[model samples]
Target: MKKAVAVILLAFALTGCGEPKIDGSSEQAFQTSMQKVRDSLAEDKRAAFNDAIQVIAFSQVSMKELMQAGSGDEGGRALIDKKIKGALAGKTGEEVIDYAHKIKQERAANQ
Candidate 1:
């Protein structure tokens, strides 16, 4: 009985350790990358780039809304969803959100 209990406890602990959490540090990295993209656009004064930025921002905001919903913040989630559906004109909501994060990482790395 003691051996079985010990084995089960060990298994439980190991399983928990396998999943990784995105904490404050990772979130900061994401934000820093986004800022760099914005700064680059401002410096260049490219009209097309500015338009793309607007779309990307819409996507990113929608993603945040989805995350808020998952976190049990229903009001925030609904607002995000409504904004995404109503304001975003070109890209699919999912693609826009995913691309924005990808761009954020690329911007951070290039800087």
Candidate 2:
């Protein structure tokens, strides 16, 4: 699972770093989005992630699977990160379950 996440984050980071000037707003958005994900998990969903380390909380599935399930486009990292933001802002519980379910389903599909 961690391997899958590393691959996804690698692909995500590589795709974004293609240019010399990185967009500052997007980076800020990612930071905010990541924080929201951590906070939401810590506050309402204990099963999702650890709030202290600011990393993925769920150990059962890879983030790639969750993004695939949530966005269904294999979207870019920023886009997927935004989706998670949306989950945290609007539909916290449902989105988390959706992410988890989709992660498992996607992972199984690949295996």
Candidate 3:
């Protein structure tokens, strides 16, 4: 019974672990990640986890813009999604947003 239970639990956990969430918007994505972290982790870790998720979601916006720029190209959009999801891995939301802002500043200065 224990072995069966453990196998089932492991399989279920693995399913969610490998996939990255692609949210429609940064805010929505962060909210979803925060909720998941809040539900699964201790209270003390929720804030940090939430911050990390926020960064991913924020950075994810760049992907959306890129996809939109290549609008109607399904292949291009799919590629953008994959790249953004991978980039969001193990990052803080604040860190992502701050980096984005810095890039924007550099672009503006160059202009």
Q: Candidate 3: worst 10 consecutive residues by lDDT?
A: 18-27
Candidates ranked by lDDT, best first?
3, 1, 2
Q: Estimate every model's Cα lDDT from 0 to 1.
A: 0.53, 0.49, 0.57
In the range 41-106, model 2's lDDT, one tens digit per residue, is: 535554543331222234433677666657756555445555444444433433545555665677
- Local accuracy of candidate 1 as per-residue lDDT tens digits, 1-111: 999999999999997653122122334543453444444443544344445546555555756676778899989876764554343333332333455557777878999
Score residue 14 of candidate 3 by CA lDDT. Answer: 88
Q: What is the lDDT of residue 1 in candidate 2?
A: 100
**Once model 3 is optimally superposed onto the true structure by TM-score, how far is the C-alpha of residue 48 displaced, in angstroms?**
16
The Cα RMSD of model 3 versus the native structure comes to 8.8
Higher-TM-score candidate of 1 and 2: 2
What's the C-alpha lDDT at position 3 in model 3? 100
**Best candidate, lDDT-wise?**
3
Cα lDDT tens digits, model 3, 50-88, are 565554445455766666747787776666656665665
TM-scores for all predictions: 0.26, 0.31, 0.37
Comparing 2 and 3 on lDDT, the stronger one: 3
Pairs that clash in candidate 1: none
For model 3, state the Cα shift of residue 43 in Å.
Answer: 17
Q: How many residue pairs clash in each candidate?
A: 0, 1, 2
